[model samples]
Target: MYKVFFRICRYPHVVIGLVNITTGEKGYWWFSILHEEMLCEEYHVKNLKGVLLDELPQNGGWFDYNDINRI
Candidate 1:
């Protein structure tokens, strides 16, 4: 299983980036917050670099798990 990390954007309902914890692969494409919410509820996507959904940082580029603590 891969842990997912994300950063929020200026838009309140969008995610700007996604990072795969183990592989360090990043997805720069934007994602809908609603979709991710569904993913969390249905698929049990729990790991967001140990941060809560409402606590994700905003206005930054893609980042990996290592950057979570620094952010």
Candidate 2:
């Protein structure tokens, strides 16, 4: 299973950060909250929580590929 960290952006937009606990791989993506459940299902992410905006990198996208690698 994967552990996902997320933060709500403007309106329906959500920034999602994922860590593959077993492989130590990480990634980030964004989508509407309306599809959050679907994302969890597809990713097999059973654990998820909200994070402070400050916890993320200061990038144009709120986060970047390199930031996720550090997470």
- Candidate 2 residue pairs in clash (backbone atoms < 3 Å): none
Q: Candidate 2, residues 1-71: lDDT per residue as tens digits?
A: 44555444444655667566677676676555556555446546643363222223323243574544343
- Model 1 lowest lDDT segment of ten: 50-59
lDDT of 1 by residue, 1-71 (tens): 33345445434344445445555656643445665556567556643433323422333344344443333
TM-score of each: 0.38, 0.46
Q: Which segments of model 2 are wrong by more than 4 Å?
A: 37-47, 50-71
Q: What is the C-alpha RMSD of each candidate to the true structure, in Å?
A: 8.9, 9.7
Superposition error at 34 for model 2 (Å): 1.1
